[model samples]
Target: MKIVLIITDYGSFNNFLSDLAIRLKEDGHEVSVITSETRVINIQDKFDYLAAGIKFFYVDFPRGFNPFAHYRSSKKIQKILDSIVPNIVHIHFTTGIFTTLFAGRVKYRTLGTFHGLGFPVLSGLKKQVFGAVEKFCFGRLDKIYVLNEVDYKAVKALGYKNVEKYETLGLGCDLSVFNPDNFSETWKASLREELDIGVNDFVFAYTGRFVNFKGYDKVIRSFLKLYSKNSKVKLLLIGGNDPIHPTGLTENETILMNNCEGIIHIGFTKDVASYLSITDVFVFPSVKEGMPVCVIEALAMGVPVITADSRGCNEIVQNDYNGYVVDVTDDNWSGVYEKMEQLIINKDYINQFKSNIQQDRNDYDRNRYVICEKSRYEQYSSIEK
Candidate 1:
């Protein structure tokens, strides 16, 4: 079977979907990718895909909705669809989701996975407008996969009965790469030294794109409050800022990140495992998410997480068990700070949570989830045929 996976950016394709593509290929299927130049600052060279023996195509789709951009992208998608005539079409990210919806008369078996609620962070009129758009788009897809039950219930409640299908997919992590046993005391010490981190200093790490919806400001403010009181705490920020992207950090956020003390701002890199190895706690306050891979990766590394109590995040952070999920009210930063302070002051509690996470690591293994995805694709292909 030939499968075409569509997404908004090459980075997501590279970071999240590449492994699945490889797995599909090994299962005797031809796997290709279609991506838009949307919400991504760093686009990988064609040689990168060529080296991996996967065919790649790009559609000039903008970050957000524009009538002209959508029309242009639909034409491009039609051209690709005509050429590939894939057995299955899997779409990811928001732009790709909307593009597929508006694409005229899709003949292939189409599947979409919601990374988070379509209009989760939006409010009032904006939410209503985008929510209607998403409902219309979702109705067109043959199947939809959501990361957690929260998303499943929300999507199901959208009232698309007898047409659209929904499934709650448990996302996974690469245990081989993210396992707790991957690091040693010597290696941890070396990495800490390389990053100018003290041996006894407690490190709180955040890895993801620096977007406003990611609540970077909230985390920064909380970290600042914690840092002012305790000199032993440090912040390790991973991921880069894409200025072209609508949700990318604002000018003020960039300035704050630069001026912050005891905050190690390391730009995005593929070497997340190395950073995770040296980190003590994982902190992610993303406003919206669809089963974040970073959170799963952190759990696999036996690191307890402090995250926002929103869909996707709440599913992973089993409050006071593996991690703490704070409510994102008006005073979101204070809520986060309290959780961070509690963990920082209580080493025994943190260690216990780490142990609990280690025991449950097998549940988030990448191989298992890939098998589930592969099976779903096979079923869809059979039905389509």
Candidate 2:
């Protein structure tokens, strides 16, 4: 079966997109990806290399809610759909309402996987356009893949009956990159040395845009709380440091670092899986998510995750079994992810952390999710007798 993956969430050799393409190929399905732009400067080389083996289409993303932009984007996608007519059109992220261009072009199935809470810049009137498009696009679909329980409940409440979350069907990671078998003693030694991390010191990592809604502040605050009591924990912040957010790292991160000890700040880089490989615990205290790629990546890497008690993150983790989840939004929000981020680091934490996932890990495999999605496409693409 041929599948078209629409990505409006991210750009530039992204793990989510690449993993989907490669895994779908492995599962015997033709895969293609369409996106707005890479958005980041100087990453074109990496993107070009990635596009070599994958089918890619790029459209200029209309900045404002211009009617002309919608006309252009829709026409571009319509042309592509008319030419290819994929069995299933899977939307990974919708950039603005303009994404409705090809949402329902296929006569078969249109599966929209809500990737995250709306982009931070979207609010009030800007959101109206998105709602109009989403309602129309979703109405035309055979299925909607909600990544978390909250999104599932929200969609159902919004009057959608045919939606099935399949948060498990959301993008997973390459477990091999994270597999301990692939690690070389030399590489492991150098990585530890370069990060100034000791063999024994517990490494706590939180990966995501340093934005307010991501709950990075909670990681800082919680880490501070933990540092005050015990100085053994080490903190690592991974993501682009954007200052515009109410909780962006520019202002708060400085305060967070100054007030907290045993912290390391590593800005944007493509070696996220490498970082995940060494990390003992992964912390994400997001207030909202469609379904987080970062959290799923960590889980696939076999690192236990501590995320917000919100919808998307909760679906990936089991409380006190795989990891911990307590919504810190109520109060003491600062020390949230950090507070629990340390739990996985502490070798002594014992029963609180499930060191070995074993058979439990199969449920979150990327290959399995892709297969399920492709199966849906095949069944829908076939003529109903």
Best by TM-score: 1
Clashing pairs in 2: 218-334, 219-338, 221-334, 221-335, 222-334, 222-335
Which 10 successive residues of model 2 have the least lDDT summed? 40-49
Candidate 1, after superposition: displacement of residue 246 in Å? 7.4
Give one digit per residue, the lDDT tens place, for model 2 in 59-135: 66555557777777867876776677777777755453235554335554566766653422246975676667566
lDDT at residue 214 of model 1 (Cα atoms): 73
RMSD after Cα superposition, model 1: 2.7
Q: Worst lDDT window (10 residues) for model 1? A: 160-169
Expressed as tens digits, the lDDT of each residue in 1-385 for candidate 1 is: 9999998777777777777888787777888888854535343441355666788888866666687788788788878887999999988865677876675657888888777765655789988887887776687778767677766666767665533323322557778888657788898899899888998999999888766567666777778788889988889988876575443435785576678768998777767888888888899877778788888888888889998888778877899999898877545478888988988888898889988987888887878777877888888888843
lDDT of each: 0.77, 0.66
Which is the leading candidate under lDDT?
A: 1
Tell me the RMSD of model 2 versus the true structure. Answer: 4.3
